[model samples]
Target: MSDQATLEVRNLQTHFFTKAGVVKAVDDVSFSVGKGKILGLVGESGSGKTVTGFSILGLVDEPGRVVGGEILYRGENLVGASQERMRQLRGNNIAMIFQDPMMTLNPVLRIDTQMIEAIKAHQKVSDDEARQRCRDALGQVGIPAPEERLKSYPHQFSGGMRQRVAIAIALLNKPELIVADEPTTALDVTIQGQILYEVQKLCAETGTAMIWITHDLSVVAGLADEVAVMYAGRVVESGEVDGVLDAPQHPYTAGLIGSVPSRNARGKRLQQIPGMTPSLLNLPVGCAFKTRCSYSTPVCEAAPVLSEVAGGRQVRCHHPLATEAV
Candidate 1:
C-alpha cells in the first residue's frame, strides 16, 4: 500500500491453543487498505478471513491469540498494544460491523439508547447532539423516518433495517478504518446492493479505508478496489480486483472465480475445486492448496512463499498461470 494506508497487516499469524495442539487459524497473512480504498478478503468458510478481522480489532477471545507478525494501523503496531489502548481506538479510529445485527444491537434497548451510548462511549457530546448525529447516520444509510425508527426496539426492524442500523453505528464515529465481516450476506439482493452503494459512497466521501470480509465474489467485484484470496489460513493470491479476477494467478483463485455461477455457461455444469480445504491443524507439508490443485508439481511439495508475479500481483504458488494465456 501507499504511505496513506490506514492498515497494514504484515505476516499476521493468529493461533488457537487447543488441547490437541496449536491451530494456525490465520497464518502468514498480509494485506493493506489505503485511505478511501476498499480491500476485499474473499474465501470460503473457515478460511481464517473472520479471524484476521478479529485480530485487527484485538477481539480474539480466550484459547485464541495473535501469535506472530505485526498488525500496523497507520504505522502503529497493535499486536502489543494494551487493552485500554485498543479500547480507545476501537470505536474512535477503528470500527467493525459484525455479520449478525444482534451482535451489535440490544434487543431490549431502543435503537436511540444503544446508538447514543455508543457515541458517548468515545466522545463527550450532549445527548441531544449525539441523538442528532445518530439520526443523521440512519438517514445516511437510507433509513426512512429516522426519529420514528430510533424509538423502535431491535426486534421492531426487519433484518435489513437492523443491519443498516448496525452499519450506521459503525460510521457514527467517523472511523479511519472499518472492518466489515460479510455485512450484507444476510440481506436480500436489492437491500444488499443499496447497502453496498451506501458503503462505497461513504468510503469515498469520508476517505475511510475498509477491509470487507466475505465469501461472495460478486460483492467484491462491484465494491472493492483490491482483493485478497485466502485458502486454509494463508493468502493465496492478491492484487487489483479486475486483474486477479480476470486472469487469476493462483489455481485456487481461478477455481473460486470459475465456481461463481454467473461466470459459467448457462447450461453447463458449474466448475468446482477438486477437494475440500485441508484441515488447518494438520495442513499438508508444503503448499496448503496442493492437495486440491491439478496443476500441482513436485515443487508444490514445499511451501511456497507469497511471491510477486507480473503486474505486482502476488501468488503463493510455484506455478502461477500465464497471464497472457488467461
Candidate 2:
C-alpha cells in the first residue's frame, strides 16, 4: 500500500428514519483506503458494511441519508456534493460492484452494448475505441474469448461469468476507487479465488483503491491490506490485516477471528461468539460487544472511543485483550 490515500471516511454516520425509530446504520465509522490497496470492511449481516458502501456512492434511497461526517475522495469532501456532481463522479472516478451481478448487468442488453455505453457515458470515446476497451476489460477479468462473450446477453453467461462481466463494467472507466459489496459470495471457490486474484492484479496495475465489503473473514485474510472490523454500526478494531488477525486486541475482533474454522485445532469444534449482534436502533448503552465479551466490566457501560494500541492497531474497548493472550 502506498502513502497516498484515495478515499477517506471520517466519523461517518448514516441513519434511517422510520416510524418505529431512527436507525443509525453506520455510526461514527471511519477508515481510509490507500491508492492500489484493498481495505476489507468486515462485518456480519446488518452490521452496516453494505450501507457504508452505499453512502459513499451516494446511492442510499429514501428514509436513509448520510447525516454526519466527511467522505473525502482524494482531498475533496463528497458528503454534500450536488446530484449532478455526484453523477459525474460515479462510474467515472468511483464505481461500485454489487453483491449480485444482476445489479450491475442489464438482462436485456448484450454485454458489449452495456459496457460500450458505460465507457461512452464517462468519456467521449468512439464506438470502436469503446468496444476495444470493453474487450480488454473482459480479458482483464479472466473472461475467455472476450470478443464472443461481448455478443452474448447476461443470461447467456453462468453465475461466475456474469460476475466477471459486472467487474469488467466497473473497470471500464478505470475508476480510481471501487466499492465491491460481496461480489464473489455466490461463486464457487475456484471461481472466487480466480476473481480475487484478477481484482488484486487489476488494483496493483491501475492504482485503484478498493473497499471490499464482506462478512467472510477468510476472504479478507487473503485479500486485504488492511481490515476494519465492525459490530453494531461501529468499527471495533482496525489495523494491518496480519496484525489484526494474528493479535486482535479487541474482544470482538478476537471472537470473530477465533470463530473462523481454520483457526481452530484439528478435529475440534469451531469457536463461536457468545451473543447476537445488537440492534442499531436499540443498542446497549455501553460497548456494543460488552454482552458478548468475557472481559466486560461496569466501565464498559460507557462507550470507548477508538484508541491506538500496540503494533499500530486501533481498538474500541475498555478491556482490550492483550496481544499475547489472544
Candidate 3:
C-alpha cells in the first residue's frame, strides 16, 4: 500500500435527526484508500456502508447529515470545504457510481447529450471533443456500437447497457477517486465480470482510488486488494484481503464467511450469524456484536477499540477468535 493515501476518513459520524429518534447511521468509522487500490466496503444491508459512501461524497441531505468527521482527500479536508468547491470537486476530481444507472442519467435526454453535458460541465472543451471522449469512454466499458448507442435514449438500452453507460460516465473524468455502490448487483455473472474487469483496468491505467461497496464477498475476493467488514454501523474488522478472508479475527467476520454457501465446511450445514443487527437508534450497551457473538466474554460489556493485529489487520473485539490471535 502507498504511504500517501488518496483518501482518509477519520472518526466519521453521520446521523439522521428524525422525530422518532436520532439514527446513528455511521458511527465513528475510519479507513483509507491508497492510490490505484480498490478497498472493498463489505457489509449487510443497513450496516451503513452506503451511507458512509454518501457521507464521503457530501451527498447526505438535511435531516441526515455528517455531524462529525475529517474526510481528507490527498491531505485536504473535504468536511469543511464550501458547497461550490465540493460541487467543482465532485464528478471532476472525485466521482461516484450509484447502484441505479437511471439516477445519474436523465430519461428525457439522449446518451450523447447527457455524456457531453457532463464533460463540458467541468472542462472548457468543444461539444465535438466532448462527444468523442464520451464515445471513447463508452468503448472503454465494453459497450458495443458506442456511436449508435449515443443516439439512443435511456429507455432504448438494456439494464446492463445502462449500467455500462453509468460506469462510462464515472470513468469519463479519469477521477482520482470513485465510490461505486454495488453498481453490478443487477447484472448477470458474465456482464458483472466484464464490468469488474473494466473498472479494474480503469483504476490501474489512471491510478484512481476506489471504494467498492457490496454485500458480496465473492465480488470483493476477486476485485479488492483490501476489505473492511462492517456491522451495526461500525467496521468490525479490516485488513489485507487474504488475511481477513482466510483467517478472520472477529466472530462477526467468521460468521459472515461461514454464511457463504461456497465456503461451507464439507458435509456440514452452513453456519449463520444469529440475530439481526440492532437498531441504530436504540443500540445495546457495550460491544454491538456481543449479543450475537458466540465468543463473547465479560470484557465485551465495555466497547472495544479496534486493536491492530498481525499483518496490519484491525479487529474490534474483546476476545477475538483464538485461531487468529496475535
Candidate 4:
C-alpha cells in the first residue's frame, strides 16, 4: 500500500487437490515488488515459481486453488475479487507474459488479430487507433517488418520472433505490473539479451513493476533490481541482488550462487546442490530442505519462519550459516 511497492504478496498458499493427495505447490510464499523495478523469482523447476505467478493473476484452475494468504496490489487484496473485475484488471492494469508464446498467441489467428483484440478488449478504440497501437507495440519489441508480420499467423514466425510478439503484447498496455514467467528462455542468447534490454527500458520508461521468474542466476544478476530465492514452495532468502548473491545467508542460497557458471572456482569441480527438489505431494515433516543442507542440525529439523535478517533481507533457515549470513 505504500508508495514504494507496486505489488505485495504475503503468505500465499496455493494447493492442488488430486487423487494422489493435496500438493502444496505454493506454501507461505511472501515477497514484494516495488514500482519500476524487476524482482527475480528464481528456483529449480517445480519449485512453485510458475504457480505463484499464476496464483497472483487468478489463473489457477479447478482442482487447484489459492487456499490462503493475500495478494495485495497497491495494498488492496485481490484474493476474492469477482471474475468480471479480475478480467477487467488483466491486460489493462496488469499483464503477464507466459513462458510459451503459444499461451498468449492464438495459433489459428493472425498476429494483428490477437494484438488488436488485446488492445481493444480493455479500451474503447477504433480499428485504426487499435491497429496503430498494435503496430507500435510490435515495433517496440524489435520485430522486423512488423506491419507485414502482423498479417502472418503464429506458425509463420520463428520461435524467438513469436516470443518477442508475445512480449510486445504485454508491453502494449504499459501495464503497471507484469508477471513474466521465463519469457526469454526460448530465444537465442543474442535475442535474449535484446529482450532483457527492452524489458528493462520498458519498466524504466513506464514505471511498471515486474516479477520475472527464472532459474538462471545469471539472468537475475543481469536484469533484476532485487532477488528472491524459493525452495520447497517458500522463500528461503531475499534481498538486494548484490547482497544476497555475493554473500548468501542460507546454505541453499549459497549453493545456488555457487552453481552459477561465473562463480565456478578454478580446479574445484563445479558445485551443485545434490538431490532433487522434494515432492510437494509428500513434503518432509521437518524443514523441507534440511535433508540436503550441509549445515542442518537438530534445530533445522523444525520449520523455519521467514524472518528479517540483516539489511532488510528475509531468510527461513533455523541454522543459517553466519559466515554467509547477511
Which prediction has the highest lDDT against the true structure? Answer: 1
Candidate 1 lDDT, 65-133, residue by residue in tens: 999999999999999899999999998899999997756688889999989988998989998999999
Pairs that clash in candidate 1: none
Q: In terms of lDDT, which candidate is stronger, 1 or 4?
A: 1
RMSD of each: 1.4, 1.7, 1.9, 1.6
lDDT of 3 by residue, 1-326 (tens): 34788999898899999999999999989999999999999999999999999988898988998889799998888886899888888988898898876565788999998888778879999888898999999998888999999999999988889999998888888899999999998788898998899899888988999999999999999999999999888988999988899888898988888899864367787778899889998888889999988888888889999888776789998888875432
Q: What local distance difference test score does each model get?
A: 0.93, 0.91, 0.89, 0.88
How close is every model to the real structure, measured as TM-score? 0.97, 0.96, 0.96, 0.96
Clash pairs of candidate 3? none
**TM-score winner:** 1
Q: Give lDDT tens digits, candidate 2, residues 183-244.
A: 99988899999999999998999889999999999999999999999998999899999999
* Predicted structure 3, TM vs. truth: 0.96
Model 4, 1-326: lDDT tens digits are 25758899999999999999999999999999988999999999999999999998899987999999999988778898889878888988789999976566888899999899888889999999998898998899888888899999999988888898988888777799999999988778998998999899989998999999999899999999999999989999998998888888888989988787654366777879988899999888778998888888898667889888887788888876684444
Error of 1 at 251 (Å): 0.2
Instruction: Give the per-residue Cα lDDT of candidate 1 at 283.
Output: 94
User: Which model is ahead, 1 or 3, in terms of TM-score?
Assistant: 1
